[model samples]
Target chain A: MIEKILLLTVAVLLSGCVNLHVHFPDAADKTAGGEVPTRPADAGGAAK
Target chain B: MLLRTAVLLLLLAPLAGSAAQITLSLGSLRHPSFEAEGVMLSFDAARLGEADIRLGVLRVAGTEYRALKIHCSGFYFDGRRLDCPEGSVRREDERGRDRPALPFSLAWRAEDNFLSFSMHDVDAVAFSPLVKRLRSWQPKGTIDFGLTVEGDRAWLGLAVRDLEFASREGDVSGKAILLTVAAGAEHRGGAWQWNARLDWSQGELYRAPWRREAGVIMEAAGSLSETTLQVGLVRLDVMGTGSVNASLAWDRARGEATEWGFVTERLDLASAMDEWVQPWLGTLDFPKWYAAGHARFSAEWKAGGLRRFYAGLEDARVADGTGYVELGGVNAQIPWEASSPTDAEISVAAGRLGDLPLGGFALPLRLDGSEATVKGLSAPMLDGRFVIDLLRLAKRPSGWHGEFEGGIEGVSMPKLSRALKLPIMAGSLTARVPRIAYEDDVLRLDGALAIEVFDGGIIVHQLRLMDPFGKERRFIAEVTARNLDLGMLTRTFAFGSIEGRFDADLHDLEMQNWQPLRFDARIASSEGDYPRSLSIGALKDITALGETGQPKALERVPERSGFSFGYDRIGLSCALRNGVCLLDGVAREGEGVVLMRGSGIPSVSIIGYNRHIDWEALVARFREVIAGRPGAIIE
Candidate 1:
């Protein structure tokens, strides 16, 4: 069961990376745009 | 033109024949690539002599340096060329403090617009403007660099020491970095063809899930156009890790990689997982994993998605740090393509999941896009064979979903029980799980799982598990067991001996994290014409289950030659809710419940006076009974 979960997690993580859209923080204004990239909403749960 | 004007003005200066002092001042000078304001120069014209030059502001390649000063003790000039053989450059801080001077050399030829400059031990922060153009991180350290430009070609050599940098968001950061970079570029066809090499020997870096700690070298050849950057090949070698060869095409305007692919040399799986993969699993409630062996991996990304991926594992072994799961002697070749179906195979020598030891098995798999399928996968499981006739899984935007049909056959009950740390039991268990499905984070059984054991059958119905791998995992099911021999059950559990057959019904059973939360449970002697008897020890244990200080009928029974009694029937019921159980027995007798009724001579009735008991307390008493500490007396 754990092996299966690990495999599923790898697949999901890869898919998530494929769809990732990076937003670089604005260099001119440090406080204006310094947010970590958003993670998928459903990424919190175990891979079912 | 600016250099010509300065030279012309110096030639017209008064010369004292043998050694003449010449000073030239320009309010401002400008060129396509360079600009300076309030420039001043003083030097001897007859021979090589001391020279001092200062500029209020100097701009080169879109970067500005203010309050810059250069002192050359051996400056020479001839017709159309100028040289600063030995010099030092300094910049005044905002508070008017002169920074430490850095040694430099300069040579220029106005004949063909050729220039060369080198500086050593220069503060890396002074080059923030150039670094900012490439990334938003702020750098601090020292650098030694040289640049040469002739026509439309340029060469650069840079070495940075003790560099520390971080982006404002902290997603990218490095510390104590020591590296050397050499790059060259030539303009051709309105673009720059560039090749570069970098050797990094020290530093720890964090760019989200990618971290590096020293010993890395990268060599790349690429072209940069106005809207795109293309790398023909990039070879990255990481010390003590592995190497990767890749190519990429990036759209500058879109700030995205249009296409990229990489193939890794056989990589050490243990190190790779710790360095690159663990961070992606941040804070997850998963067992830490340790891996061994080597694997080759390749992947391609195109059109903004992963197009293909392949992995070949060579005798790999992965184990859970918590000792719950392990796979040893595993080898597999897995290939997945977005546009086509592929076949893969994997073999394992031995494995374990929790307490169940697994035997070697090989499986064939098929992959197509986001779906995977397996047919007829079987493995030896604790004296039985676990067989999955078919398994299918698909990845959807909503999440992952899957289903499988499997069964456990001829598994020894004693072995299973011992493996699971349960009491030793007789007989073997066989179960047929028709279908199990997973969707929306829930795993459910479509049909019942019937396990035959102890000359009886246990049927589990309506089984559902929520968030099976999450912190708040929950399991719900209804179970029924028929005609289980009480003699075997008692002996197995170390409970006081009892004879006859019994049936149990457990409805609406709910458990969170494997702890019972709520249930309606009933156990009764099977209705049959059979001898029913309970040992004196069992009677004491049953009576002890009543509420503390509650009087029980078993106290009146006198000692007899045979330390046992005959009972007509036995029954008990408990409906649990909110940590409490509403208890009942076969029939109510006055203020008590008839747990056992007398049947023959010397028989005694057993009654329970408590109708409400704490569930935990009841379980504690049951454990005590099973452990042979009856905690009750009959005098």
Candidate 2:
């Protein structure tokens, strides 16, 4: 049981180590660590 | 026999002089007259069919008498013939002061070596407003006969420099400073050499109506023909503040079907160059060359509805917080080809709004259609699709409809307070509306808005609004601000800060008599639910209300959620646009019912003050405040 608990802890630690690879259009990559703004598809509201 | 020979020699001597000999070089030229070393110089005499000059060149300090002023008849063409000394010039200085010669007529002269002519009383143009403004005017300058060759195939070239004159209206009172003018020209031909060229002291005029200073460069070139004349290249920096790079070309054919075409690099529905140059359109017949910077094409012209006014604008950056009506700058871009008024298409890119000093703001706009009409007035409506807190309308209209798309980052509550010209809770917002409509000058937005306020600031995550005008009165929205620093909002508007949180909305607001009236808004600052020195200072700039308490140990206390909010005296007031707001009532304190009704735009004044209320019972009172009515009191 103690070994199992140790394995679970290691798995949790490794999960945070997972690197996320993201690609974006040139315009969206203007700055690092920032989200690009996007316009609404139409003037209609979401409910419509 | 000797006497008869002498008479015959004298008679035959004059006949040998038609050899087009070199004449005296005229020294200098002044108004009404100039001196020629050889024959008398005059444009008036030349106009009488064919002018003739009789003189000789002062070569080696000698005059052989070879040039002839044959009149092909008149001898000495007096200055009166050319109306030189007697010629009166018109003035371009005053508005309706009865000064006629604004665009003076061109004058000229001819001689053996040098000839000169002068043009005075040239009209100086003035733009609109207090600054220098002038009507239509022709550039005024002089032409000098630099080097004149006479071999029937003679060539005439004038240095054409240092030609000084005014191109702007002269103020009668002041030493009418005119548009500084300087230019030069040259021409060569046999029977008739047509030559004229003009250049400016400045490079070019590219400024908008909102811009203070402007400059422009214009050039026109063409050979004179008895019939079927051709129009050369001409350009007008239409916006006075934008680019006038279009290419307009046309050709004249003989064997048949009159062919003409035009093209452009970037075509706008309402052309900036065309509008500026249209005044001169009637003066000269030119095939519309809308595209001056790019392309090669041409089309026929036709007339349509409301040619002049194509777009209606609502610019409000000038008077932040003033309900819609007080527009700062107005511009209308009509759907007309740069060169041709008919049979052409124009496109509108984006326009910036906030740059006007009166209401400085930046708004980049894009137009969708080539044509749009407001109340039957057709104009090139700009496809506006930009984010808010960026730009604004220039003209405050009775009604409006617009849609633009752009992004505004990092807009804070304090800035919004200053822009809206009012007080509010602190927060930041990043918002965009697909469309915004204003009818009767009331703003109606049809879109969605998402916001997050952290650290005493209103933050916008995403906001979209637009109104197409359909069922479901849609809704005019306003956010409720709580626990905000009223001081920040006031200072941004240059009105100083007040202390309070505003839980109020103008409720689909608009201007009535230039005043923005709020039907309901319940506000209560911990330190002031009533009239405080801060509120009074913000409104009337008076520091005679409420106490100025000294800072307590809690002054350094960090913002804590548990220490969230505390109630104080409640107060309300009627808002006025631009500036001014009437108190809804006298400063009221404690637990009291604030009655509101549709009474003459609603009035406010403090009635009484109360203290010590049961915590459980006060919840109902809070609901009452939202309803703008006296709530149930179990005091």
Candidate 3:
């Protein structure tokens, strides 16, 4: 039973390693859905 | 006969006692060289009274003097001679308080037909009729002279003071002239042979591009006839400078010099250039120069054209004020003829062009008419040699044109870059140029130049330069770089390192005054690349170059193993126009472009959303990246 438990732990660790691919939201979809963040204007700016 | 008549008239006038008045009139009085018409003489008393003599016309030599009047006081005659110890001369037509009478003393010896006269404070305007060139200049001066004439010979000792004259254009002028002259003349064979010595002790004279200041003495001998004036020899001694010997033949009718020549002793180059050469160089587009040396020059001119010229220099050093050109230990002997070819040589110990230093060289030159040629000329450059197989230059009616074939061999790139103030680079540069031609202020390459640098080859085609030395200089060319190692380029420019090979194509590139104006440039990874990878620093730089703001995707990478990443391909393109660059990447990924694509584990890709960017802003960002500043985030 301890050998089987060790096998299951090894499998879980391998699965975690395999699922490590990074995921980023599509930039175009974010812009289309009005979810893109806008940077704030700096204070104390000189007038043109 | 005329002198005898004048003596008889003076004797009869004095015979009339102190209280007696006498008047005499004659139709005309004539001599071989002197004549007078409508002559009259009148006197009252013999001691204190005045004698007035008026003549409608007085002709001396070949010039006519009209309305001449001579008024005499204390006149006396001794039967065979006449003397007027106090006399004054005037012109009837002159009407101004400033026109004062000229004082004179005269004695005539009837025995030998000899005349002696001395005049004081004679205005130079009185002789303007004889010197046609002075009529428009409005000469103002006073002259004092003593003249003695016997038969066909004459002698004059003259002194001029406070002379001032100028032309309307102000190109020819003189001021504060104090001149002393001793001249002698004799008439023979219907012409006058004359010689004079002139000393200009204090004055300033300007004749167009030539100027003269005080302390000049000239001794000249010439013959003047009806049709020509020939100066046999003229020796000029200028203060602080050497002498010059010259001669000229001038045509009186055409008012031009038919032939002229001059030979100068070795002159001090510094003084000569300042006083004479600089003024004449105003029309040429050349920088101001300072020189030190001694040189001798000779030239012949005929029919208003140069016929032959010769110049020799010794131990010369010349440098421009702007530090663009300099030469030292220069010695040369150059001779040129208008109709025949001549060979010459120049040797230089050292020189510099821009910032590049040059070693010593001796070059042979050939000149004929308006053309010059140089064959097999070689000069030492920075750790290399520049060889010119042949060069030919000719002066055309439009301007100057030339052609040359040359090559640069084994020049160290690092040294060249340092000299040019560019980034330090590795390897050596070499180029072979087939031919370059220049015409109409434009220089163009007839064939492409293949240059080896950065372990690759760059072929430059359609290269042209316009007004290379002028303010509006321009350069145009197209270049193709093949298999350039990216590591070396990035290291040279201080860009983050990437291990790969790339090829670049730059088409229709143009620059004005060394600033880029337009170009279409594309850089892509070379085919069959090896070990293609980018470091973390390089990845951040690439991201900053393309994206407006930092992407959250970069933060997702595990920090433990974030040293480098493998890349499948890299590509970037920029088309510059109107101060804006239209940018692109390798391929489309949804609505963005893939700047870099990952190929292995722990790899990452960059996507660019913006397509158009300000060129100046882009360059600023690039500078910030190269300086290792934090990546800029813009919206």
RMSD of 3: 9.8
TM-score for all models, in order of appearance = 0.72, 0.32, 0.71
Note the Cα lDDT for every prediction shown.
0.74, 0.30, 0.73
Q: Can you tell me which runs of candidate 3 are displaced by over 4 Å? A: A1-48, B1-153, B157-165, B175-177, B184-194, B222-230, B251-254, B284-290, B302-305, B319-324, B469-473, B499-534, B539-562, B565-635
lDDT tens digits by residue: candidate 3, B441-460: 78899879877666677888
Top candidate on lDDT is 1
lDDT tens per residue, model 1, B547-588: 443233445454453566667777777766655556566677
DockQ of each: 0.01, 0.01, 0.03
- Scored by lDDT, model 1 comes in at 0.74
TM-score for chain A, prediction 2 = 0.45
Better of 1 and 2 by TM-score: 1
Best by TM-score: 1
For candidate 1, what TM-score does chain B get against the true chain B?
0.77
In terms of TM-score, how similar is model 3 to the real structure? 0.71
lDDT of 2 by residue, B1-635 (tens): 22332344345444333443322223322321122234333323223323333333222112122222222322222232221222322222355245332221222333322333333432232111111233333333333332232322223333323222333443122111223322232333411223333333332232331111224444434332322323344443323334332222232234222322222223342333345443244234321322222222223332322122222222211222212222233332323333333222322322233321123223234222332222111111112122342223332343343333334444565554444434343555544544444444344445544444422333221222222222212233443444454545444333433444433333233323323322223344333243232332222221111112222322333333322122233344332222222223223334432311111111112221111112122333223322322221111
Steric collisions counted per model: 0, 112, 0
Please say which candidate is ahead in DockQ: 2 or 3.
3
Considering summed lDDT, which 10 consecutive residues are worst modelled in model 2 chain B? Answer: B595-604
